[model samples]
Target: MNVLLGLSASNGIGIGKAFVVPESEKRVISSKKIKAEDKPKQLERFERSLAKVTGQIASQLDAVKGDKVQSEIFETYFLMLNDPEFLGDVRKSFEASNHSIEYILNQKTEDYADRLRSSGNAYLSERAEDICDIFGRVLNDLLDFHPFDIEQVPDDAVIIAKSMAPSDTVILSKRRIAGIALTDGGVSSHVGILARNYGIPAVFDIENILDEIKTDALVIVDGTSGEVIESPDGVALSYYQNKITKAKEHADKLKVFRDKPAKSADGESFQLMANIGTVDEARVAMEEGADGIGLFRTEFLFMSEANHAMGAVHSKVAAFSEENQFNAYKRVLETMRGKPVTIRTLDAGGDKIISSLDVQHSSSEEKNPLMGLRAIRLTLANPSLLRTQLRALYRASVFGNLKIMIPLVTSVEQVEEVLAFAEKVRDELKSENIPFDENVPIGVMIETAAAAMISDCLAKVSDFFSIGTNDLTQYTIGVDRENALVAPLYDEFHLAVLRLLHKTIKAAEAEGIPVSVCGEMASRTESVMVLAGMGVRTLSMSPKLITSVKELLSKMSIDELKAISSKRLNSL
Candidate 1:
């Protein structure tokens, strides 16, 4: 047996026959010179191929309708197909080249993908993969060849791929594939996120496994440990089989904690909440027994192509309108059944560039987007957009408990501005005879260094505080979490970040307002202990992590957590 070690992405175990997915990037295309007079016919052929690929994506979208995240991903494929700039470049290339449409299209798309890969931005780099996926689909249509069909993949078979696009992951998820092992992906890649959301076992960064392992070989994927056992002998197979049985038993045990109230051994009660990005995830939060929805990322409402978030600024399709946002927010609030739902306003820009909002910036790249106009800065500049979201939120408030949390709040002035605008929205709704919770609380996200330093001032005006450890660590440590060169330095446990967390929590406590940690740090055991010890009673994270964190909380007393927190603060 040959064992391979890689990064553990999704936690689970799977034993099945290996199915090697074909790599579209390896396709060979030979240039066929075309006459200038035949340019019209060539362009028509390209249009036909584009249409066919678009139809396939639409079908995929129909299959995964309720999954807002997956549906949006497929919609992005539509936008990529209809991207005016890319299409213009293709036309220009066709005019300049004597080669076939396939050759020119491939060359231009590769150039675009290469530029994105070298952009030093993780979000854009992933978009490069999406671009390649779109290109492959179109090329397949043009060449009239279908090498692999995902639906034909055997049920519960382990999928082995060099790399998987978001669309491929969505399709494979429907079949309930046994597991996924990839040579190119990480914990935060789009495919990785999908695998976790779908509750599938996944291992990433398994270099050269595709070359060594053959199709239909018996494979054991231990996603919890990032181990892939190929052609295991009798002993190893028996051992893994036992492990799988125990894992199933452990999962069954976890269900007991699902409906239990979150409390420590010392009788210290806490709120275990879920951070969700879609209405569907809010339902998951309920299923996972989350006390509330801690961080409701509203960007998906705008980022989804169906919402016209990706169209041109003046596209006939409007962006996430007041009605669209209201229905989405109302559904999530109702799903929680009166449980508190903290919804953050549209946090576009930075890594998330909403095409409709920043048409100019999307065309002309920004050198330092993360630190540039983003979050509150971007929304405040576009008052109509921010006001529209506020109107929708307040209109949906009557459905259930709701709190508005503003992202990247660097100043008390910013907090006051949002509060003022929100009041005006409520007033307008009241004048129009619309019902809403007049006392809906507005909160601040302690994500920036400035926000943490001035937390006390912010707490005086804000209703509550939610520490976004991801951005707080990035801003405090002056490191981009996605940059491989500096990722090791982007420590969430850094002394400065912990101190900031403590400071923010203290500030909120002094003001008699609630404080919470809603980041990846909150999902980890050790980090949860430290945060709880630091006076954070509300810990919000992924829905899948809630039960595990609740179980850990139940095992430790308040005193033990305080001691752990003290040691971490003093040493690290």
Candidate 2:
């Protein structure tokens, strides 16, 4: 048997015939050099070529029988082909180079690939390869050669690629292929994540997997251990077969917790909510028995190039909370609807800055972005962005239990500013005869020492408090979480951090504002009891952690938690 060997790298299982786009053949052409007169013709030619290539890929995907993966893969490619940025880049390059459409496209792809390969950053290098692969496939379609259709691959063939994009990986049929081996990719790449989600055995960043592994090789991929055995002996094959079986069984067991209530053993209940970024995730959260969405990051809505929030924004937001049986906000008006979905409005700044907003706001690379204006500070500075978000939230409120929570509030004044802006937006909506819940409660995320220290004052003014322990710990300990040298000092369990948390919880309790811990610490079993003892009633975390946290909660009591909280406070 032809043997293929490479590290089990990506996040999934299954395989297909590899579609390799040679990186050396890629070229980049500068867009600035093209004469203005030739721009329109070049763009027209580029667009036609793109459409033709997309059509060819679509046709090939349609020819594949019973291959669900292949279908998803082509669909994503279609999305990318239609993406404004991709098309715009082609046009820009054509305009600058004053070259023929093919030359411009080829040069652009090559330039991108070359820059990526030469970059010191490994992640950028892999991303560059994905770009080349995508454009190369498009180019191949335009050139009349179908780049290795999925229907052409024999069943049980393993795909070998110089690199794979996440979108490309998603389209492969999971049942047909044995596994995947990449010549280049990283653990954090989109392809890797998609692989994990699909439970397909994958290995990435294998230095020469493509060179070593031939087509139709019966290579054994050990995803759990990141190992690949070439033409494995009977002993290794048997071991992997057993492992695959066990993994499937374990997955089934995890699914059992889906519909069950996430209550602790001692009958003390803590809300288990999902942190989601999209409407798709919201559906998954409901299926997973999430009490509500703990965090619906709104940045995803603003990801498009358009400054205006999309037209479907309200409908999309409503879908998450409205029409659901356990809508928390309606059940407990003070909280959010069917399992309250607490939303932090556009927490941009730091690494989350978008280029579009940066250009409008004239945001330069800050010497210390972490310490600079960000989150609430940035929003407060640009009231227009803040107002737009408030309007969207107000419009979305009529659909379900929607609560607004402000991030990085360092003082009472900041809280006042956000509230003032929110109230202003509410009034405008009312004047416009728009329906909105005027009493929709607002909360503050206790992420900074300033916010934590004055939690009592903030609690009195706000409806609730969510302890953002991740930033709280980092800010209190005066250590950057991303700084490798001082990362060890970014401990959540530090006495100062613990004390601040205890103080914030006490302040919230004194003011009678319900408190929840909605950070990474909420997922930690060791920290749960302490948070519970500190009188925190809710914990919001990733959906994957819900069942495990529920299992832990089922074993603890409020009284015990309170005692632990007291002990920690006294010792501190």
Candidate 3:
């Protein structure tokens, strides 16, 4: 068995023949400068290509009317294509350098992309891909290159590619492909977002993948674990097939609990909702019987130009006005149609910074973004930026059950400041006669040890608590999960993290406020039980994991889980 490990972009099981999607190099064939007189003609050619791409984007919007995620993808491209800075900068470069349109476009975009890539913010760096995507399509159009059509791909074939554009995923999804594996692409990429939208099994970031797997080989993709198997023997095939069967059976069984309350065997009940980044994911969560959206990652609205879905983006929101932010919240609120949606404010810093918002621009140069001013700290430091989002959320709250959450909070002072700012927005809305939710829920994310330690204080002033285990584990244990060499040291159920969780949950329960486990940890069956045992009555995770998690919750006894927790705690 040839085993390949990658990042799970989407979840599912699939077995199919590998259909390699060949990648073509995109580059300017001619770099020679045009004469002064030919500059106008070159400029005209550039405008025509831009117009064509614009038309294509408009058509996509028309085709996909209400798919906000997909619509945002095209809309960002349209924005980039028509962005005055981008267009004007490229034109200036051509005028000065007299370079070919392809050369000028490539050079200017790369220059902008380089700034973003070197911003030291991981999520912001990913926007380099967006810049490349927008300009690369225009480059291809200018060169008269006819790209491969997704419609021509074989049906039910596993798509193997080095990388995929959002459009490629969009078009190929309609072709009924079995799965997708990419040597390039992050779980936060636009294509990754589309994969989740269509429920396609996808794994990405597998290095040297094309050279490892051959075409026509039977491959088994376990998207949840990010494992892809090539030419599995009889035993392995049976194992994967049985696993698939069991998963489906499990899902079907959980369907009975769709309308049922999440009450434990001992009569302890919990709020089970979905953690989503986009509006479509909210719809999926509702279909999977989620009570409400426990975690609505509003970061996707800011990073729409980059990866575009499933929030938790530690990056910057640039050139995004109050109207832009307001419309994003309204779109999501409209989609949820009154289901409770918790919107986490910008968690910028430590690898997530909006270069534009970074007044000092010092954050983009920070060696350690994870430990730097991020989340609440970043928002507090930039009150105007915070107000921009607060106003939007406050305005959009009237459309649905909206709750605003502050992320990476470590102090009551920060919570107080945020609340004051929120109150200011509410007052302004009222004064302006703008319709808004005056009593929208205000919450704090219990991610850092400081925040978890003082949960009682935060709970006193907060309406709810969401435990962000992904960061809690990393920070409490002093391990950067992103560092490959030290990733193995990271453990979600570590004693330190468990202790923090126990304290926070108890504090929230004491205050009579709802506490939720909204991290990836809440998705696992064992972790879910442990969380419930620790007194966490609300759990939020990805939409896809809802059925399985609910299924496991339905089978387990809270009292027994508490017993296990006691035993483990005693041992620890």
Candidate 4:
């Protein structure tokens, strides 16, 4: 038995035969010159390949089922497939250099991929692989290369790969994949998010994994410990078999709590909601018995509209249309089916910064975006963006129980300004005799020390308060959660962060306004218990964590949780 250490991208345990998914070999294109007459034929080939790849993605969008993240990953790929800039670049290269279709596409993909690879933004750089995946398909089409058929992968096989793109995850979800092992990929990557959402055991950064293990070899994937065991025998195999049995038993026990309320042993009932980014997630949350949606991040709708908006200078229209925005909001609201849905307006910044949504409509090449223009600051600075979003939210409000919340709001004046602007948009809709919910509740996120301090004032003007513990901890303690060097110092259990949460919740309680903690902290058992002890009854997190949190809540009394929280915090 050989134990290989890797980083856990998702948590679970699985035992299955290894299935090595080999990467598609790139075909060599002719680097030779072409005649002017051949240029037209070569350009035609490019367009045909584009249409073929576009159809492939469209088929996946229709065929893929159950997973929301899978659809989103493909949607991003769809946007890339139709990108006018990408098409124009290929055309220019083909006409100028008189190169073959294969050469032009290969060059264009590599060139754009290089820029994204060197962009320094993980969100952008990680997307470079998706670019490679997209163009790889088209290039394969032009060269008649047989791409890897993921559908034929044996069901219940542990997939090992050198690298896995977001689209690859979409393909995996279509099959009965047991687990995942990657030679090189980050846990913060989009595929990682998909893995967790789908509850697949996954590990990454296992160099030369295919060489270490053979196809059909039995493997044990311990996502909890980030260990992969190859060809286990006797005692080792018995131990893992027992481990898998216990996991199954625990999961079965948890299933019994699915329909139960998230209440402490003493019967202190609480609302457990899900933090979703898409309408499909909303469906899953409802399936998991979620009370409502704690946070619906709207930025996922405009993730890369900047592609066209940035290219508009040459010749392309921005994809930031209000109708598209309204549809996204309407779908989620309708999916929730009268359940409370708290939608956070675009909180794009740091790795999430999209320049097309920017006030100046500029590229996001900032040295430091986390502390710079972002969230409500970006929206407030650009009234047009805010108004567009406000109009969409209002239009969608009539479909369900909608609650609009502002993100990164630090000042009372900012709250006032947002409220005033929302009202103005509401008035415009009314003047036009547009249909909408007239009394939608407006709220603000308490995510900064300043916001926590002035929570009393903000709570008075706001209808409700939701604490974004993730950023609140980051800003209050001066630790960037994304920076690996300083991330170790980023402790959510720190006394300072606890103090801020305590202050914020206390302020909200004084004003008789409901407050929910809609952050990562709400997902963990101990942290959820601690926050509940802090008088936070409404907790929002991933839909996958709903049952686990309920199980933990069922085991302990509210008084015991309060005691544990008090003792734990005083020790700090």
Candidate 5:
């Protein structure tokens, strides 16, 4: 048996035909080169090439048939193909340089890949491989090369590629694929996220796996421990097979709790909701017994645009509403159809760059953008953009159980302003004789200290409050969670942050408005117990964590939780 040794980086395993990276010549251009007149033609060629490649991928998706995971991969590519900034950059680079399209595209891709890798942001760095992979495939498609067939790969093979794009990962169906080993990528990459979603084993950043591992090698990927054993002896093979069996058994146990209610031993029932970004995720959440979608991050629909346009923004919302109108909303409504799917409006700002915003003339380049103008503050300032999103949410409400949520609301006035704007949209729709639900519940994300402190007042006007503890803890403790330098200070267990959470939950309780926690903290086993004691009525988190949280709740008594909370609070 062919054998190769490497590390397993993700949970699932795959064995498949290897898509080796093809060699290409890198062309370089000097600034002193003549021919300014040739710029437009080069740009036109580049745009046309991109459009053609997108068309090809779409055609490929149409032809392939397997599973949702595979379909998502193709859909992600379609989104990238239509990305305004991606295409616009290609055009800009071509116009400014006197290099061949191949040279320019490769150079740009490499530069971006390097920047992402070096930036220390796992998500951005992982996406770098995707950028290169997508561009390379697009270029190859332009050159009349047929991409690999998804249906023909052997059922139990691991796919070894130089790198993988988000689109490439999306197109793969989970049933056929087992594990993934890549020469490039990291934990935060698109491939990594996709792998996790698919529940497949993956190992990334193994720089030379493509050159070392032979095709059809019998490799065992251990995702939990990040190990890869190649061409194992019978003893080792038996060991892995037994390990996989045990893991499956554990997963099966979790699945048993999928349909059970999340209730504390003392009989306090709380909604276990899911935080989702797309329609595909909506399906998964419903399958996993999520009460409702707590955070429907609408930003994914807007991020493709380098310059956020009102018309484009409206269309994206319309499309999301239209495509998902029947199923996405219907699933939540049917599951708890009459209950609420609290959709948080776009929280754009900080590190999330809105391509259309003019940042050159801003007062100061924010030294720390994450804590800067973001969420409701940024949205309120951009009235037109905010209005477009509000209109979409208002329109979507007619289809099923929907609620409007404003992110990062610090004051009563900000909440009132958003409510007023939402009312305007509802009135306009009514005037137009458009079908909609005018009385959709409005809520606020209590993420900042100001928002949490005055949550009682805000709760009076709003229907509910979702505690965004991720930001709350970050701001409360004055520590950036992403900054390793002060990571130890980023503890959610800090008495100040816990007390603030308790205060916010109590405030919402006093006002008779339901409260929930929708952050990383809500998903933690230990944190769930604390939140229960704090009187949180809901816990919204990643769907994968739902079963465990529910199981944990089933084992714990509310009285015990309250006792712990009382002791913790007294110590403070």
Candidate 6:
């Protein structure tokens, strides 16, 4: 028996025969110079190959149109394929350097991918895979080579790969795969997100995993524990089999809470909401017995519209149009069926870069972008961006309960600025005979230390407070969580961060405004208890974690949670 431990990406147990993905044969591009007159023909060939790959990716997009994350990833391929700026650079290179199109394409794509990989942001680094995947398809088409055929992957096989791109991951999701084991993938990678969404057991960052696991070998992947056992003995295999059974049983038991309201042992009811990025997730939240959506991250809607679809490359609207935003928000609102949806207006820039936003200060220009123009700052600077979103949101508000939340709000002035802009939008809509909800609530996200510190004043202007611990932890601790060198120090449990959470909740409660946690910390079982004890009555997290959190809260009285929270706050 061989056991290997890796980062647990998804929670589940998967036992199946290993199906190691075979590496494709490396292409040998001829570096010989071509005639200058041949440039037009080479460009034509490149366009043809690009067209073919674009068609392939479109088909993939259609297959996953229901899944927002999958579709967003596939849409990025369209952006890369149709990016005039990048393609123009490639064309210039083709004209200047009389090299083969394949060589030029390979070199250019690698250069961009390398730059992104070295950007120090894990999300951007993962996007490097998308660049290579799309360009690789184009290169393959140019070379008349077919990549790994997903059709041959047998059902219930444990897929082992050095690394996986979203392209391969999307296709593999259709199968009844036992699990995924990767030597190169981060917990925040798109592949990892897809795995968790699909409820597939996945373990990533297993060093030299492909070499250790052979094809058809009996493998047990314990994603909950980040354990991989290959060729396990009967005793080990039996142990994992029992674990799998118990896990399934536990999942089945959680289903009972689907229709039950979240309440404490002492009968105090609490709001258990879901933090979602797309309309599809809203439907999932309902199915998961969520009270409402606490955080509807609007940045995703902007990200999905990157480069403005396939054929409409240079559309007049750099980001999602009012109509596009309206339809998306409307769909989510309609899906929730009158449930309160707190939609945070575009939290773009910073780590969540939306190229479509066309911010004047790009990450390349800013030395430290995380604290630079992002969220409320970006939207406030560009009134048109926030105006378009506010119009769509208010327009969609008529469909259901809507609460507008501004992100990265540092002071009451930022909230006032957004309110001022929103008023202008409302007046314009009224004059235009557009119907919208006039009483939609506007809230502020307590993500920065500045916001949390002045929550008492912010509560005077804001409708409610949503604690975004993900950013709050990093900001309060002065550490970038995405930075591997300093991520360990970015702890939500730190005394400072806990104090901020406590402060935010207390301030909101004092002002008679609801306070909720909608960050990664809310998704944690222990963190939920701490927050509930700290006087937060609402907790929003991932849809998949709702039942477990609900279950945890059901067993613990408010007093018990308060004790736990007090102990942690006083000690830690």
- Among all candidates shown, the one with the greatest TM-score: 6
- How many Å off is the CA of 137 in candidate 3? 1.8
- Kindly list the per-residue Cα lDDT of model 3 for residues 1-572, writing each as its tens digit: 89999988898988899988877665536867678889888888888998788778767756765566677666566667666667878888788886788898888888888987776544556668888877888888989987766666787788888998766655654578778889988766777778887778899989888998887889988899999998899999999999989978877777888777777776777788888776567768777878788888766556554332112132333534678778877876777678778888887566553434334444545656678877788778877778888888888887888888899988899899888888888889889999986788899999999999999899999999999999899889988665445767989878889989989988998999988888888888778778877777778887767766766777778888787677656744
lDDT of each: 0.85, 0.64, 0.78, 0.81, 0.68, 0.85
Tally clashing residue pairs in candidate 3: 6
Cα error of candidate 3 at position 354, Å: 8.1
1-572, model 5: which lDDT tens digit per residue? 43444444566543334433432334233344437887667667666877787777666566543344354445445555666665667668877777666666667778767865565443344446656767877666444556564444456666767666565554455346677777666565666766776777887656567666667667766665666555667887787778778767888999988999988877788899999765557767888888888888765545433112222422122223333333444454445455567777767666454433322212124545566677777777767667766666666676678887899888999988888888888788789887777678898899989888887789889998898998899888888655435665888888988888888988988888888899998898778877787677699999888998988888889888877667667765
lDDT of candidate 2 over 217-243, digit per residue (tens): 557665656665566677766766787
Model 4: what TM-score? 0.87
Please provide, for model 1 over 203-264, each residue's C-alpha lDDT reduced to its tens digit, 9 standing for 90 to 100. 99998988978889999988899999999999999998998898788778999989999999
Decreasing lDDT order of the candidates: 6, 1, 4, 3, 5, 2
Per-residue error for 274 in candidate 3, Å, reads 2.5
TM-score of each: 0.93, 0.69, 0.82, 0.87, 0.75, 0.95
Q: Give the clash count for model 1.
A: 0
Q: What is the lDDT for 564 in model 1?
A: 92
Clashes of each: 0, 52, 6, 0, 25, 0
- Model 1 residue 66 CA deviation (Å) reads 2.0
Q: Model 6, range 475-500, lDDT digits (tens) per residue?
A: 88888775556767878899989988
Q: Give the clash count for model 6.
A: 0
Clashing pairs in 3: 314-352, 316-353, 316-354, 350-369, 350-370, 351-369
Candidate 5: clashing residue pairs, number: 25
Q: Give the TM-score of candidate 6.
A: 0.95
For model 5 the TM-score comes to: 0.75
| Model 2 clash number | 52
